[model samples]
Target: MLAIAEYVVRGALSGAIYALLAVPMSLMFVTVRTIDFAVGAYALIAAAVCWSVGGALGLAAGLGAAMACAAFMAIIFLALKRLGCEDHIIYALASFGLATALASLVLWWWGTQAFVRDAFSDPWSVGGIRLAPQGVINFALILLLVGALHLLIQHTSLGRMMRAAAANQTGAALASIPVQGIQVGTYLAGGLLGGLAGLLVLYSAGLDFTAPLGLTLSGFGAAIIFGIGSPLRGFFGGLAMGIAQALAAGYASAMVAGMVPFLFVLLVLTTSRFGEEALAGGRP
Candidate 1:
């Protein structure tokens, strides 16, 4: 029973990290109807910067790099919007190209070597289960993010405007809400969050160029499993995925754990007719 409990706790922590990574992607999908393939790349950039610089300066540099990447994405996407490229496919292609470019850049600059953050030399432990300080930090940040999102969505005018724009872009614009500004703001915030997730990932597992694709896939799987429209649902979905993977790795094999996300993605795709209909404000 204790072993089971340990696995459950470990899985939940992993899920929290997955949820954190998924939130930014989910937010962007709902708000701007754009899938940012570069989201994971943004995280990679932050982590690489953090590793190169170290300490507080590294942290700030990492965040700044993420913000800059976000700004660049916003500029390109907003330009696409202005240039009559309204199709989501175009935006997706643009994001994919940007992500590829960024990955190449990071590879050239940072090399393909992997490194972990090692935040705590002595991680906290209880009942034979060890917990990294970085994991605790990740959980705390997830809670803070969820709380802030809830407050923004429930208690603020900006939240209302965001909802309005998400529900019906034309109606929101007709209502005179700053729809474009809201989307731009969402992109910026998503970028920042994406960067933070990257830092957390670095702390937990280290990173290489390949990390971006895995992170991106995991984020999408989590968000899609719960229907991307709801951040809270996505969070829980991520938690579930993490738990399953942990259990698989603990009882089965590490190879199985690595494949769990792909399996989950396929399960959702084959089982649900929705296929991310939540993006259209529909529930999964």
Candidate 2:
């Protein structure tokens, strides 16, 4: 039971980090029906900067640097939007190009070496279970993000507009909602969150150039399971997924690590669908 609790905590922390990366895609998909692939790209780039700056500035400064990166992604993506092409495939390809360019730039600036951010020398632990202060910080950020998102969606006119826009862009336009602005704003927010997730990972596990995209894929898997295709569903769903993942990893056969999460994701998706189908059949 003690070991189980530790694994659960570990999963939740890691999940929150990757799930943060997942939310932007879910939110963007809700509104624009497509992902800004640049989310992970910009995050990876920002993390590299964070590592470079870790020598003099520290974690807080590193996060600011990460946010700046997202801001740059927003500006460039919007500028591209002004050129008048929103084709899904085109947008994805363009985002890929942007991500590739940014990664290259980071490589040139930061020499592809890995960085491990040791925030706490004495992590809190109990009975063979260890907890990082940074993990608490990660959980807090996730909660704050969820609270803010909930407040925005429920209390603001702009929030209403965005919800409407997500449901139907044409209708939203007819209702005078600025869909383009919403889209760009989503991109900006998503990029910021993505960068933060990357920073958290650096704070915990360190990073390599090849690691960013892989992390993004992990987040993507979580997003799919968390029902991140919708922002509102993102918060709770991501939490569940993170917890599930941690458990799988804790007891998983050491020889089969790479397959564990994938199997878990497949299981979750299958179960969700099966449950829904059973519910539908029982509705009679």
Give the clashing pairs for model 1.
none
lDDT of 1 by residue, 190-260 (tens): 77888888899888978888787877777777877767876776787788788878777788777577786
TM-score of each: 0.92, 0.84
Native-referenced Cα lDDT, model 2: 0.69
Kindly report which residue stretches of model 2 are placed more than 4 angstroms away from their true locations once superposed: 55-84, 126-128, 273-284
Cα lDDT for residue 198, model 2?
Answer: 77
Identify the candidate with maximal TM-score.
Answer: 1
Candidate 1 residue 107 Cα shift, in angstroms, is 0.6
Error of 1 at 50 (Å): 1.3
lDDT of 2 by residue, 1-284 (tens): 98888887777777787667777877666566666676676567666777777654655565666566666666766776778766766766666677677677777777778866787888887568778888888888877886787677667897778778877788999988998889878877777787777787777777776665676676676566646544445555566667776776677777776577777777766788633432232110
* Model 1 CA lDDT for position 212: 77
